[model samples]
Target: MARGPAATPNPTVAARDGMVLPAAGPGTGTPLAVRGLTVSYGENPAVFSVDADFPPAAMSAIVGPNGAGKSTFLKASLGVIPRLAGEVDVFGKPVEQARARIAYVPQRASVDWDFPTTVIDVVKMGLYREVGLLGRLSGARSTRAMRCLDRVGMADFAHRQIGQLSGGQQQRVFLARALAQDADLYLLDEPFAGVDAATERAIIDVLRDLKAEGRAIVAVHHDLSTVPAYFDHVFLINVRRIAEGPVATTFTPETLQATYGGRLAATHLDELAITGGA
Candidate 1:
């Protein structure tokens, strides 16, 4: 266990504008690799030198405190937010070149629930990247969308307006949308935030299914207790990479304190499990 902080920038990672990134090795079995990734808001760096590899067919959690750049790292990796430095690779290829293989679900709060869109309509939006904006959703595509909704246990809500549903329902709708994308990798920000216990279980079931199918699922998770139960890997970040690897070994109390400071005393593994139904 290499403790403390991440090592100095590896020479293998190429330099871009003075930002050194970790190079993707051949046959590393990792779908995603980030090297020396740095993102800044004006002069303040949101994410400093970070490096990690996300294995294929696994669930990984990005854990950190507020303002720890969890969301910033996700956006920067997807190129939705411009990174001040570093590089991101998907399947050993640049993110831009592998765009179609990735799917993203932003925070529920970040979306406007008031948007006059049906549940099915929102799921269909996932196909827009593949089918194009003007492309029509034929009977086949519409059926596919319905199947995705069914996966998230929201088939009955397909006709309901997004805003009319409860918070948990809304989150399921977004998960269904990501499922419709049919991408190789999924990046979700706070998928369980503000959702009921039922919704949390439903989402976790779907994510586990995705991992079973040889796809990668990376999520920004806040609950420390459930992390060990939910994910196979943990990537801890606090402005910089604190520790990243298997949850059992890397997600230690020491790393948690290093990432969240002294206030994380309550992040224990024996708390009440929310994986049960509501």
Candidate 2:
């Protein structure tokens, strides 16, 4: 039998990420395409016309300095924004129709940390899509929720209050929540923001596993240093597209500077580092 990284065969990915995805069926392997994408806040344009596609079965990192519109782009792709000028297509189909096949992990900082909730209770939200908006949860769904928590090393904290968890632990919970959805496309915004190295590695390992499953991952990441080492595909964007390609090509300093709006000093990068995002 022929084999790709996951030994499926017919897998044709070229991210140079050393990140390989499982063999994906041709029918579900369509990439996420954005053309003439423009997002704005009132009269102030946030993102200019942009064009690109996240190929299926690849890990793509979106990086830039502060105010680069990386998170805005993710919102546009998901139709969460009020008005958008560009077109977003997933697997050559409209994004709205592909909702069930996609999952989203917004920044940990954006969540109401003080809100009263338990770890497992948070993850149970992920199953809502599959169980249905009105679907009652059987024990099966609850079991799956705990299993997902274990996957991210949060099994012990399943009953702990979400506000009490550390930054890294919280981030892992976000990953687990998304995994519980079992979607084909994953869009994460600053998942590693405020996360410790160990937590970062755990999150990365989960993304890698998802890649191995042939799902597409798009992360809004601000850590420029890890872009090359962590992602196979990179999209450097400011208000417009600066550079996009395999990390080997798009992770260069020139592109970094352009994407961040001129040369960024070390101090500036530190400031741009996301602690919490909404």
Candidate 3:
């Protein structure tokens, strides 16, 4: 949804049924928030009434079955796609006004890996917002880009064409690009998909470092087993948000069953014990 100026907090309303809507108040530690966020494709609604907060220094995962509107939420929130109804805020401000502080890494499948671009070139693209379209990445910007690549273990492949790299290598390169953006709030779409174990570990480490820096990271994750281990918070969804909170409390067996509609077998729930899904 295209947003206007930041809206004032609805003073007449506070918490509804003891639930804190994504409105800002004194000491609301949330950095990214969505209220009544809805999106549709033709006559079909993809997302419905998603209201939540991306708290500071937290790694939150949006988990659900395929076609659950996981990708649609991210795109709609970022204004990359039109929404049926919603409001997105960053640090108590509207998303459009806070675009500079937000960085988005779309799913690898959404990108054209065959595009003719070098690793460094792709990484440098992150700095284009800071540097003008015609601006060059000289001095500090160049240093930052290279440092980001190094962090993702892709510094050695800076000169290689992106299409020539392996799936994991390409994911790492794209992650490096997001790191180079140096934004406070990151909205990633399946950062772990199609990546090797080592790359997944590296990406998780990077997410931890970002959390340490007081940044908020939200990713659309598919692996139920790793959801508890990887994310501090989880949002269980199926077209609409089912439950969202700290992993320990919110990721229960009943909740998972509700989210997945009992599609998860008993053995599968038992194995996801860490997620409290047993």
Q: Mind giving the per-residue lDDT tens digits that candidate 2 earns over 208-253?
A: 9999998999999887667756788988888888888888755765
lDDT of 1 by residue, 161-189 (tens): 89999999999999999999999999999
What local lDDT score does residue 5 receive in model 2, on the 0 to 100 scale?
Answer: 62
Q: Report, for every candidate in turn, its global Cα lDDT versus the true structure.
A: 0.87, 0.83, 0.86
Q: How many Å off is the CA of 55 in candidate 1?
A: 0.8
Give one digit per residue, the lDDT tens place, for model 3 in 36-119.
999989788999989877778899999999999999998999999998899998888888987788889988888888899899
What's model 2's lDDT at 218? 94
TM-score, per-candidate, Cα-based: 0.85, 0.84, 0.88
Worst 10 residues of 2 by lDDT: 269-278
- Candidate 2 overall lDDT versus native: 0.83
lDDT of model number 3:
0.86
Answer with 2 or 3, whichever has the higher TM-score: 3
Please name the candidate that would achieve the greatest lDDT relative to the true structure.
1
Kindly report which residue stretches of model 2 are placed more than 4 angstroms away from their true locations once superposed: 1-26, 266-278
Ten-residue stretch with the least lDDT total in model 1: 269-278
